[model samples]
Target: MLLGSPTVTREAAVWRRRLGGNPFTVAPYALSCRAAFRAHRGSFDARWRRLQQLAPLLSSTAAEEGGSLRFVPEAPTCCQAHVYLRGDAAALDAARDAVLRERGVRVYSRLRGAAVGPEADECYFELTLGPRHLEVADAVYVGAWRAFFAALAGPQPGGRKGVGDAEPQS
Candidate 1:
């Protein structure tokens, strides 16, 4: 389900990176994704509830209260965010692997993308939620998180280096 109210999609930059006006447009992206999710009715509604319930379970392990892991905005071009979860290095690594093995957010289908393993202590995964099956009042995040948590149940790849510094993994 949508985390909360929708953010504003303004003509100008909602947040200024240079000036340091952060935390803008977050609501709009979430709302847009929620809106898209709401269109499908039956499937979307169920999925949304599942996603909302599961997100906290996965995020419970987050290390930092606000950093080191979090969710990303479905919209907005200026800022990038992810639903972060904190744990030991090993735990994060395993979470990364679990996502890849499952081919979804936490364990199964949530958004429309893939999850890759970690670079090291830093883990990077991409979630590209589409316009279909989205809405403003609510959205699905748990399905994606399921795939994310599953990755943690294994080992990191040998050749995979710089996971944290690498580009988005979807």
Candidate 2:
């Protein structure tokens, strides 16, 4: 579920109303991936670096509809960046699962089409972060994350990281 200030909630509600559906519930809504870090552990510098490092990886997984990463006001110490993707459920799910398995990043699927009517899916997932010393909290899905990252680091035929080289971590 989305957790934030009234402004953020209002923004989302506005976007949802304008779009006719909650982006989080619509099948073809934007895929927003947020990497939120703990407040007490890392400096802003460190969190910024981690956010930068993760952006490319997140974008690399976007579907044909396109994607982007940006910083927005969230909790005081949380380094929150969102990835927006527009595509089908399969494609969106693939991207979401990849991020989940790869970094255990906290992700929220939001956006609602104003004219899509009542069929929009309300199903979604959320992660609870714990205290950690790292810039970003450890992914809750450890096994998938390890496998995904390991595959990302896997060797390529010409020593180049192959596109889509890493399969979804089962």
Best candidate, TM-score-wise?
2
- What tens digits encode model 2's per-residue C-alpha lDDT throughout 1-170? 67899999989888878878754576443332233324334465555555554444443443111332222221223444433333344534554556665456535444322223223432222222233424343343333333333333344456433225554588
Which residue ranges in model 1 land beyond 4 Å of their true spot? 1-40, 62-68, 72-82, 85-95, 98-170
Model 2, stretches more than 4 Å misplaced?
1-41, 61-78, 89-91, 94-170
lDDT of 1 by residue, 34-91 (tens): 7755764455444454445434444653322222444443222322224433445555
* TM-score, cand. 1: 0.27
Scored against the true structure, residue 18 in model 1 reaches a CA lDDT of 47
TM-score of each: 0.27, 0.29
Error of 2 at 69 (Å): 7.3
lDDT of each: 0.41, 0.42
